[model samples]
Target: MKRIRSPQKTAEKLLLAVMTLFAAVASVIFLLPTVLTITNSFMAQSEINANYGVVFSSVSGGSKTFISEKVNLKFIPDIVSFSQYFSVLFKTPDYLLKFWNSVILTVPVVIFQTAVALFASYGFARLTGKLKEILFFFYIVLMLMPYQVTLVPNYLVADKLGLLNTRWAIILPGIFSPFAVFLLTKAMKRIPKTYFEAAMLDGASELQIFTNICFPMVRSAVFSVLMLVFIDYWNMVEQPLILLNDEQMHPLSIFLSKINTGDTGLAFAVAVIYMTPSLLMFLYGEEYLVEGITYSGGIKG
Candidate 1:
């Protein structure tokens, strides 16, 4: 006997297929630039210049002109070369310095910001009062506000504190950022009150309960926040550019634009290197990130 699908079931299956196809296409579209950069980074500089020189070339008399020639967008290089990476890694000291500067500025922010958010989130999760709600609301407001809106104030405050022109200007604000607090607080709140009750009945002190119960339950959320905060600070441009007047103090992100204009070939290689940390972090923490985000208020048995 032939099995027949109901009209409603057939429609649902069709919709699912359509959505899946759309998602696949969207994913490829999103990944296209990353794929292009990685592949093109391996092309020899002469080949890169031959392919993209027209796009980057300036008109005479120091003026910009629209590209008259179509750019050759090659996915596979005729010849692969490591010269660009070699130059960025070994031949150039400035590139390495800026890369280290990015690391120096980003690592401390990720570590300390996660620490501060964990404690602050625990407070928000456990406390119950109009005051706590009001304060948490303020944090949401600050998080919602565009960083550009607060950049000027941050500048003024950093100037007053004599942190301008120093790495502290970038690190301090990032360490106390409210985004992680907002996320971790929500995650901690999702943990059942029964767990806390059990801990309290066991004579667990606040610190002990926080460390053993809350922290363990919210571990995935912590990883998610760390990955997020790392990505945010790793790609920071405006903060360092505005706060640090010393060109040498600027992170690689600040130098990326200049590199793009001057050495297009180097830009591709540097961009790949710049992307590596965030990419690796994401790949490693992807499962935790999804679990942390989608987890509901239920304790796993």
Candidate 2:
């Protein structure tokens, strides 16, 4: 007599194997575009323009090329040189400086917006008043509005305030986000009122309660808001394009568009470099961004 196996068990194992193979194929299909772009960037101009079937001689001023072997996409050339990175990083002078400008502009925006949103959120969360509800509603409306509608008003105010052609045109507006207020206020509300009352009983001022008590309680929410703010301002193209006329003040996002036509390679290189900081920041802070959504909003919210 032999041990018996159920047909159901066999079916389940077969299903799982098919699903796993499908997932692996899906992953490769999605990543193939990015992988190809990065790989192609390292290929020499000759290789880039090389006929799909024609294999060219590497020697300069050589005779007609022949395609004998399938060109391996994995390993591009004998040596992968940094010529593209070097030219984009060095040959482009003022355009490259736009990177630092973006950094400076974004750092201030993140700090100021996060701070303002935290306080505004505290008001909407804890303070008792009809005005608070009204103000909160207004912020929600403004936040939900499209960027195009808001751009004109923002430009006018920036102009009247003499913020045009300056970093402030972008930074100042970014500092006050309704989305941040909405997210953070919900986070703050989740904290039990008992803590606030307890702090008040101990003669703690609102500032003290906010700094010492409330701040610690909602640390994860802050990270979530910071992530959004960083991405929004870091990729800013329209605002800088409209607000700042000075080439020097334009952020990398705006500057990248300027040189896009002449050389596609440099644009790709700059874009790859420009997107690095936001990627690194989010990768490291992903846990907190994800944690805040769960702990503070919807379902458990």
Candidate 3:
């Protein structure tokens, strides 16, 4: 007999549809700004001016009330143009230099931090003792401490070491990030101890076992760490602001914040360009990110 769904089931389905629609709306709202930025990057100067003119107009008077009666949010370009991109690439040489500065600053931090974390994690996971637990607890505490708490101490150390206003000022602190160590250690500890025992039987050295066995097992975790560390460093502004007094040495992230209202199109173009590396990184490693989360501590005896 073909049975129809009960009224309760029908009501549950209707409620699910409503919740789904709400979630979709919320997602669209969250992503609207990014969407607008990308679309407006291709918009003509006239269109951008037309849309955002009210917000940018200078009210040079006593006690001026800054209130916009109408706000325009544009998602579609009137005419596709590459003028903004050209302006960024060719018209301004400083922007290119700052872009390179970001690359230089971000890449090394990600690589070195991940490497340090990998080795530290191996030691933590393999070394069996209560001392290891105590050390890891300290790492967690350090990781939990906010940047503001550490900033002054880091500044003191950097000044003492004469590393202020240099790339080393930023790189050194980043290379020893506690969060990376914590995450990598957690993943590495999940690895089976039996693997080490088997590898030892073949006279495999610790380094060899780590490279051939531990690394492959924690590949997803490594990818996750890379993506996270890259993103964090890529968007870093405060460290550079405090560490480097010279504006010329600043990364693209700091410059983006200082962009004025007149350079709306240029801002959009720069934004789109800025997001490309992160977007690409996320796309490539998203699967590993999911895998890392899912398979963490999966090999339980």
Top candidate when judged by lDDT against the true structure: 1
Question: Model 3 clash tally?
Answer: 0
Q: Write the per-residue lDDT of candidate 3 for residues 1-301, one digit (tens) a residue.
A: 9998999999999999999999999999998988988998999778888888566665565233556568788788878999999999999888888999999999999999999999999999899889989999999999999888999999999999999999999999999999889888889888888999999999999999999999988888889899989999999988999999999999999998666445777888898888989999898889998887677534634
Q: Relative to the true structure, how large is the alpha-carbon lDDT of every model?
A: 0.91, 0.79, 0.88
TM-score of 3: 0.92
What TM-score would every model get versus the actual structure?
0.96, 0.79, 0.92
Query: Candidate 2: misplaced stretches above 4 Å?
Result: 1-30, 49-78, 258-260, 297-301
Supply candidate 1's per-residue lDDT for 295.
78
Question: What is candidate 1's lDDT per residue for 19-56, written digit by digit as tens?
Answer: 99999999999999999999999999999999998887
Q: How many residue pairs clash in each candidate?
A: 0, 0, 0
Q: Candidate 1: deviation at residue 241, Å?
A: 1.7
Q: Which stretches of candidate 3 lie over 4 Å from their true place?
A: 4-16, 59-67, 297-301
